[model samples]
Target chain A: MNREKVILLVEDNPDDEALTLRALAKNRITNEVVVAHDGLEALDYLFGAGEHEGRDTSVLPQVTLLDLKLPKIDGLEVLRRIRADDRTRLLPVVILTSSKEEQDLVAGYSLGVNSYVRKPVDFVEFTEAVRQLGLYWLILNENPGRV
Target chain B: MMDRLFSLRVRVLVLVLLAVVPAMLLMLLSARDRRDASEESGRARALQLARSVEVDYMHRIDTTRSFLAPLAQVFALVPNLSNVTQTACASFFDKLIANTADIFQVGVASTDGTVICRSPAGAESAASVAAEPFFTTAMNSRAFSVGHFEFESVTQKPALHVGYPIIGPAGTVTGVLYAALDLNAISTDLGKTADPSVSFITLITPTGTILARYPNPEQWVGKEVGTPPSLAAMESGGPGITRESVSLDGISVVSATVGLANAGASEPGAGSISALVSVGIPKDQVFAGINDRLRDDLLGLLAAALLAGGLGWFGSGVLLRKLQLYVGTTRRFSEGDLAARAGPPYPRNELGALGRSIDDMAVAVSERQQEIQRLNEGLEQRVADRTAQLEAANKELESFSYSVSHDLRAPLRSIDGFSQALVEDYADVLDDEGKQMLGRVRAGSQRMGQLIDDILQLSRVSRAEVGKEEVDLSVMASGIVDDLRRTEPHREVEFQAAPGLTVTGDRRLLRIALENLIGNAWKFTSHTERPQIEFGAEGGPGKPVYFVRDNGAGFDMAYAGKLFGAFQRLHAMDEFPGTGVGLATVQRVIHRHGGRVWAEGATGQGATFSFTLGGSS
Candidate 1:
């Protein structure tokens, strides 16, 4: 159960990725954190393409942390694609962005993002955000059954 | 020259008066001369009558003397003087009297002034004249003598006595012979004139006694003559006419008078003839002679004057009608009706030319005004276009600011996150200075993030859709102050918020603005020992100026000018730790609602933030 409890983080910025990983690690969230540097890469991993071509497409993560600013498919578009697909329609996705712009948050939520969170500029606040997210999604939140 | 300024009718009248007045005066003068000439002709006629009377009298006296001489011859040659008896003389005298109309009696008297044989004999005829002066003078002088005027006893008529003495063979006067000459026949002879056209012809004595008068010879033959008022000029036996003279019957007349003595009278009667012949014409009759021509000429002149006046009036009426129309046009044009035209149907003379000029000027002015109006209208469009361009530019700027704000936060977040991670992850290797430096970097990046957020908030409120509603500011202020207390729970701050404070505005924006105000008050009063904050709407109902007041360290009024400016701070950063954008955001939000915000406070004293919403309470 713990092995299957995985978290995916789609982020383009290396610093944000490193900081997010550090925060997750410092919070002792031992769930597997699958890191994708771009929205396309993350989509590829989620749909079992490219390097993860042979991976079981049905083995989905418990939660997806989507970053809005990306190199290839933006976060909102990825969420739209994910929601359009029957397999990932019920999956929980949280939007994470350095910009706390209201339009982005609203768009993310309208596109079926389960939650929206801003990347705090402070390490302590980021850690606490990560810890609470981990505790709720990895431990308490019930996940969809594998199709 | 002066007539030119007057209207045509007046000018016509004036010109006619000027031309006709002198001519009328000349006619009057000529008429007076004609009257005087008529009067002179009348005087000449009277002089002629006087001359005729004088010649007749002188001839009659000579004839009488000749007859007496013949008689003296006849009587002296008679051989028997005693044989010339009264019967013979009487028959001879009767024969002589029958031959002459003027001879009333012809008789021979004795040298002793005895009675003479008289024709148509009356009793005592010789005795009646026996003591007469003329008989005595004839007997004594023994020459022909004409006696004074007398009344014949038998005829009882005025007459004159002419006597001739009989001469003896010795050439001494023997007896006196005399004849009585009737003067009444003079008036009868005067009545035989060819025409009695003049008013009267009178023969007057020098004593103002009339001996004969014409046209009624028998009535005034022996009366006193009619006298003129100023007879001094004509009384000298001179021939003259007196204007405004009165006649014998007291009628006003133009009279001519002549002394009969001026006519050819011989020595016997030269100084003794005091008779005058007066021919007088009444002025009424004199004027009546030329009245028809005068009346006709005057009527012609009057008719001409009326014709001129009527022509002037009629012609001027036509001209003035057009002028009045032109006047109306001018008045309308002056009153700003540029479309007014002076003429459509008026005559095309000077007035019409003026009308056309006025219309042309009006057209030119109207065209110019239309051009100006078009320009003004174009100016409005240009202004609207310019405003639209400015609005587009402002829109571009707002979107740019929004995007800038959105993008700027990412780098600040990265910087702050990394700095904080370095301090936390590398805690064992970092010294106090390194850690503090990293902490400073974290704080600066975080502070920058906060400024970006605040700036974005201010910009958002600027462009935000104002969804107006009745927002209970009292509730909003209470909630904001409660949140502030919860945020700084350890602080001993007192808060008071009045209830039922209402206003109309966007609740979201108002909440943000009030939060800023309350937060500012809370932050500024942190140093006050007994800090009290009051959040309530002030002023009268329907218009409340909501204020968040706190007993805190206030700022000097000198810095009030910069109080609402972004990033402007009165206290040092360490003393009042904040992004310093709260009040700016508040001001922007309040301003977006068409309200304004201001603060007043002293150092270490309370500060108050007051704001007013637009239109609605």
Candidate 2:
């Protein structure tokens, strides 16, 4: 039996978060989905802070969806912190934001965020964008030391 | 003086008087001499009558003496007394009768000097005496004795008596016989000799007795002369003539007196008894002939003078009329009537010359006027052509501006949209480097779109009509700064927006200007630890200016002049993300509202953008 992989969704907009979850579901990759409201909550779940405590880090989510515009810690800072730590230095991060600003994309890529995505304004096109991201990062992609 | 001499009337009058006045004066003087000669001939006839009277009287007296002498000789020879007396008386009476017809009266005295027989028969026996003075004076002289003139009883008239003494046979004492003669008949005959035009002539005896005068013989006969100055002057000298004023027959006369003397008498007293003959020509008759001739001459001169004056006046008027016509035409031409020409049929003189000059002047003036009219029309045509060309050029420029603003932006937008779409749709098919390169392509496309937009906006500002509205610039600047802070929330920026700054301009356009200025501030200050921006107004009234100041990567002031030019960039693309059309757009917006924009900056210190919107209220 093949064990299903979990994907972490870190997005500020509810619409974008739902679109990404629907794309994974439509692709038949029924993995466990953990939703974080922003970059701060995603960090908390990884570090076992206030509301997300005592989480096992060895069974980490396969990929995190980080939105650039978050409430407290921005997506780029979260990505920097994860790349600086040895335990999550190799974690897969995809930057998903509504802005097509170049500075944000460059800063996100330099901080070791694995992929940068601009959220589409059209809902059908946004669903396609999420579908392609899921197929490449989860189905067709390979990560090291996976059980 | 020239105006006076130029008159035609004066010239004509001078010419006429010069030829006519002297001719009339010469005719008057010659007529006066002819009247004087006619008066002198009357005086010469009176002198000839006086000489004839004297010659006839002397011959009668000499014949009487010879007859008496012969009778005395016969009486002495015969010695018969009765016969002798009868014969002597008969012979003497016959001789007296013959002589009395030629003379006035004749008388004979007896030879014994006692009695005389007179030819007039009444006086024959009146006196028979030998003691009478004529008998005594004749008996004592050898020649006949002439007695003094006296009044005679026989004729009752003035007479001269002549006596001859009788001589004996041996030439001893003898009887004297005398003859008596009346002088009035001879003087009466001499008075008839005067000419009728001559005045009365009077003959006077030397003893101042009046003899006879023409036209008044009865009043002057037997009257003694009253010793007139003419008579006194004639008595004082031989052959003397004098002019004297005298009263004759109770009429005043200027008488000329001439003394009558015996013929060939040179001695003072040798039968040279003084007789004064006076002939008078009155002054009225003497000058009457000359005055009639002078009156005719003066009338002729007056008529000639009037004729000359009339001709001069008519000639002058003719010349003046021609001159007045020429002057009137000249005046009309000077008053801009070039068509005015002189009248035809002018005189052949200076007036004709003047008319020709006026016609020439009119021709010249009309030609110049025509040329000027043509030049004015040409100038107006040129101006109209120029105006048409400008209008066409303006229309072409308007369409070009519209195309730049509306059409040029469409392609840039497509490039940016398609590039952004590639990154979003094809992100999985690309590797990391390919994705990164696509990101750079999208970024470059977006930047190019922004640059096109900025350039289009700049063009639009220059082309658009400015609509004015009151804008609170301080608030607008604060709002823009707030917007910049929110655009990139990580940046720490300080804003100092001055309060109470208002200007009248297009609010939307001014907003664009402020946005560009503030955006530049924000972008350039990105490298600073604490970015600061200030917006305020400075300077006084009539020169109030607004400024945007930033602590940023200021450019060198040497290249600052190019800041407001379209697409002029100062910083490298990696340092400042800009199309470099922001300030150019600001400049265009300000200039559209009739204002100016400029920048002041230095390398690495700060930059300030100052502009004027020509504040309207």
Candidate 3:
């Protein structure tokens, strides 16, 4: 196997996380994807603490997909933490949520998340949202100084 | 006194008397004059009868003298012894006596005063010879003479004697021819000349002796003429007449007398005889004619007066009765009974005029009363309608306030909750610029939430139904100040709350009002070393007023007018954090309790807010 690229998925709902991973595998952008469930957990994972300790530091994720509502913390906090850290400051962050609330979108963009996406109520539209987010973060956009 | 003076019946009666009295007086005076005229007429009639008696007596005497003159011619012829015949003298004398039957007797005597050739031969025995006044007077005189009146022997009635001398050829006395003229016969004819209403004729000798009287001849014949002044007056002069009241036979008589003289005598002579003829009207009978007339006149006057008086009284009564009815109706109308009306179907006169006016007045009064009633009803209806409109408006305002509170708070909560979540979770992913921006957003959302709460509180004040309870305004104010201190634990606020400042009002609303006022003081005085707020009672008992006063962020008094308006902030968010709706909500709460709120301040000095919850302490 070629050296596997790592992807971080910051989602709170377990059903949405399973659907997003399935859409990435069908789109043939299957990489070593890690799930954090909340902003606090995502931050801990990136900094390698709690369950993320002893993981290879050199193998940081190429992109992160964020949900706005989460347990223990929220998606916007996770994105803010990611952009504030020096190691993950330049990393691409995508905001995803089932809510169409306007303030959440504006707040996501204001916190320097690369993109914002709303999870649709229909199953097909939700799967398409996951597919587009994975392709843009994993394959389409070239992250600088990345191997 | 007023009742007597103003009585209507007295006025009517007085007016009736005023009109009737004069007419009655005139009738009485005319009746009296009529009676007097009738009495005077009776006296005149009696006097005329007396004059007739005098004329008749004198005429009979004159006729006898002429007869004797012719006999004297015959005696002269016999003395000359020519044409002397006994048959001729006897026949002529008989015819002369028969012709002078009204005379008592007619006879001729020779120059020796012996009676001869007497017709109705008994007359010689009935007549007196030489002792007769007429016979003696004729023998003594050369001319014819009339004797004094006397009662004749045969007739036993009043008689007047007359004598004529029979002279021979050289005018010597040959015979005295005498005749006794019955004065009663003349008086009987004179009585016929006057009405029988107590008229009497009397024949008297010129010596004033009573001779014959037509009425009561036997009784008056022998009496002297001194009783009636008229009898004495008749003997005084020739053809003189006088009127007098006399007592004849113990009965009062009104009489007149006239003197009788020989027909050819212009001067008094022994050969000429004068007699008095008097007529008397008994006093009762003299006035009897007038009495009848006066009685008739009085009766007529009484009837006329009664008729007039009755008519006047009845007319006045009818008029007054109608007038009284009208007056009564008018009185009732004046006392506010506009429906009062006069009696129906009266005469058409001045009283009718009054009735019509009263009826017209009643109609006007009824119309005015109806108009007043209609106006009152309309006013009541208008007031009811306005009250209903005000109630409806109050209900609508309450519902609107509830909607604003509920709907506005929900959205603000969502915005704040999501913004807080965004800052906590997304801080790691944000750059310095990003983080700063997020901090601003979160601050804005929190501020917005506070603004919504303040606005909702203002709305609640405007629309809340005030619940009444006895509230201790000073304790409520102090409690609010303590709560505000806990909200900002580092802020220092001093409270001077008067104890036992009780008020009757909505406790919840009053506490809300005081909380806003004191809370504003707490928030505005965050920069001050010590902030002071006061709560106390103002004014007097029964009208006691509770007021909350604050010394905090004092604003310009020029702008104080806007202090109670919603969202009117005197301080910016950076200078003093507030939604600017606290004082507005306080004003609305105070106003809902029928109180008043005001503020006084300058730009750099502190603000003092004062509010009154008007109620009994």
lDDT of 3 at B608: 67
Q: Lowest lDDT 10-mer window, candidate 2 chain B?
A: B78-87
lDDT of 2 by residue, B414-489 (tens): 4444554566678888678887886676566557646655665675566566887889999999888888778789
Q: What clash pairs does model 1 have? A: B208-B225, B503-B617, B551-B606, B552-B605, B552-B606, B553-B604, B554-B602
lDDT of each: 0.75, 0.69, 0.68
| lDDT (tens digit, per residue) of candidate 3 on A1-147 | 122767888876665676667657656676888888777888888888878887766567788777776778777777777778788888888776644434467888898988877554333445567777766676677776474
Candidate 1 structure quality by residue, lDDT tens digits, B1-617: 22443465577668878877887787777777777776677556655655666667667667767766787788877654545767767877887778776777887777777665667644355464557666766776666666756567777777777777778888777677788777777667766752555677676665666667776767777676445333455554444445557776777776666554422223423354445567676767766665665677678877887787777777777776667777788889899888888757646688777878888888889999999999999999999999999899888977687567657876776788777777777999999999999889988888877777787787777777888899888888878877877887898788888888877889998899888887877888888889898987777886778788888888887788788888888888899888778778888888878887887877666777888877556
Question: Top DockQ: which candidate number?
Answer: 1
lDDT of 1 by residue, A7-33 (tens): 899988877888888888887777788
Report the CAPRI category for model 2.
incorrect
For model 1, the stretches where C-alpha displacement exceeds 4 angstroms are A1-147, B1-197, B203-252, B256-278, B285-316, B327-338, B343-357, B457-476, B496-516, B535-548, B579-600, B608-617
- Give model 1's docking category: acceptable
TM-score of 2: 0.45
lDDT of 3 by residue, B472-591 (tens): 777787778777767778776677988888778888777777777777777676776667767777676666655555566678787888888888877787998888788778888878
Lowest summed lDDT across 10 adjacent residues in model 1 chain B is found at B261-270
Candidate 3 docking category? incorrect
Sorting all predicted structures by lDDT, with the top scorer first, yields 1, 2, 3
Candidate 3 chain A: 10-residue stretch with minimal lDDT: A118-127
